[model samples]
Target: MLIETTAWGKLEIDEDQIYHFSKGIPGFEDVTEFALIELEKSSFAQLQSTQHESISFLLTDPFNFYHEYEFDLPDTDAEELDIKDAVSVRSIVTIKEQLELSTINLLAPIILNPLNRKGKQVVLHKSSYLTKHPLWAGNSILDKGGE
Candidate 1:
């Protein structure tokens, strides 16, 4: 299927690459369907909304930057996504003017059930993580923006 995007322009996507966010991402509750496209030669992937061409987010495996990153999937959320065995977790990447200063959201990671293509951005209420954490230089929060 072909979908229009603001970043990558019009591209063909496979059905398997699509994920359904029943309650939608935090701020984007209206948009539910998104295509997870992993960029070539990169550790990041784009969660592009299929319904809204302009709505897109860059995602990355939190573990890639934070080896110690850990979070327990609430039983409620796991059951909602129908996550049985196959699960995927990703963090939303926030790009900054200074490329090195970019951050990824650790407080709420995007969780996915690859087996059923269900997804959600589950917020960790018990974690010490913040909404913005440096994508590199460990998992410490260093945003001067005071987020």
Candidate 2:
């Protein structure tokens, strides 16, 4: 399974590594298949669209930046992915950068099923969350506490 990517160029991916997003990411409902590729020695990953070479997202675990972060998907979403246990769930946030700070889309997290290679970008209904939450600001909070 060889495919061309926006950032990684041409690479080989296992068929099993291909993830099926029945309802693709926001603004990309038609794009379904994607493969997760990690950036070398970095916490970031590229969610490369198998359907479109130009369509790829930079993603990371929000928890890595914000320890207090939490998200809960609706029961309907869980059923759609056939999710049974928490162990099968992996969450990633789309990265965004501003002039002052770097942010992550916490309101809509990409959830993946490692075993079945299925995924979904779920929009959380919680009011406390934001589409662009500052990941770096969260770290600054911890630093202030340490001081």
Candidate 3:
């Protein structure tokens, strides 16, 4: 299928690669379907909405930046995605930029089913997590051999 995107321009996307977010993201309830487009050889990805060409989000694997990152989903969410094991899940963080400070929303991670291409953005109930966690903070930890 051919889709027009603001970031990647018009591109070909496999029908199977389209992910259906039944509940959509926090603010994008009406925008459900999306395609995860990798940005060349970079670690970043663009989650482009299939329904709306104007709606898109820059995402990245939270674990790559934050090794200690951990979150437990409610039973309802796990059941909704039909998650069987840990390997079936992929977590992504939404990126945000403000002047010199860039941030990622770690508190609400978008979980995807690699096998079926189903996805959902889940909000962590844990108080320890922050919505605007600095992605660069993990670099300092890695520099200190903290992993």
Which candidate leads in TM-score? Answer: 1
Q: Which digits, one per residue and each the tens of the lDDT, describe model 2 over residues 1-147?
A: 999877778889888778999878889999999988877898778788988989988788877867887766788888888777742323454343443345577777788877777899888874577666666654442234421
* Model 1, span 1-147: residue lDDT tens: 999999889989999999999999988999999999999999999999999999999999999988999989999999999988999999999998877778889999999999999999999997999887887784344635545
Ranking by TM-score: 1, 3, 2
Q: How much is the lDDT of residue 42 in candidate 1?
A: 97
lDDT minimum window of 10 residues, candidate 2:
138-147
Alpha carbon lDDT of residue 129, candidate 1? 96
After superposing candidate 2, which stretches have Cα over 4 Å from the reference?
Answer: 86-100, 138-147
Model 1 deviation from native, Cα RMSD in Å: 1.7
Roughly what TM-score does model 2 have, to 2 decimal places? 0.82
The TM-score, computed over Cα atoms with residue i paired to residue i, of candidate 3 is 0.83
Residue 44's lDDT in candidate 1: 94
Q: Each candidate's lDDT (Cα)? A: 0.92, 0.74, 0.74
